[model samples]
Target: MAAVPLRRPLDAETVVVPVGQVFVIPERCKGCRFCIEFCPEQVLVESDRMNAKGYRYPVVADGKERACVNCGFCRLICPEFAIYTEEIR
Candidate 1:
């Protein structure tokens, strides 16, 4: 018997990765990890600096400036509304 592939490769022309910039209100963040934990792109991480409330907020991980896809998943999931994205263009 021959093995069957589960999927075929997509053609190069059809692939378009979205990009955006991520923003955060450090003071509005309460150290909750929802945005960081649930980001589909996994583009965020806890920063070394703490806000006035002593809560570590999310920042774009090093070398990940172009990694955000502008999906708004972080904005949708953030209870504190501290995280959002805007199209790069």
Candidate 2:
């Protein structure tokens, strides 16, 4: 029989997590929920407010501080190029 060494689990709190700041261009948004629907973290939601183009844009969900992971999925899926994310310092 061969012996194997066990690896310790990584602690999530100790890790230097990357934070994201999502930007929604209201005028450019077409009221598509792709950003909100595709967000893995569920950080975004449709805002009751309307843009100049009469489209509902995405806003960060309540109580979702530092929720975005900066994965760029929203930007990629957006047909209007209205949503994007920036890394928080």
The 0-to-1 C-alpha lDDT of every candidate, in the order given, reads 0.90, 0.88
Clashes of 2: 0
What candidate 2 gets wrong by more than 4 Å, as runs, is 1-14
Report the C-alpha displacement of residue 87, candidate 1, in angstroms.
Answer: 0.9
Clashing pairs in 1: none
TM-score of each: 0.84, 0.80
lDDT of 1 at 35: 87
Model 1, residue 8: displacement in angstroms?
5.6
What is the TM-score of candidate 1? Answer: 0.84
**Candidate 2 TM-score over all chains jointly:** 0.80
Clashing pairs in 2: none
- In every candidate, how many clashes are there? 0, 0
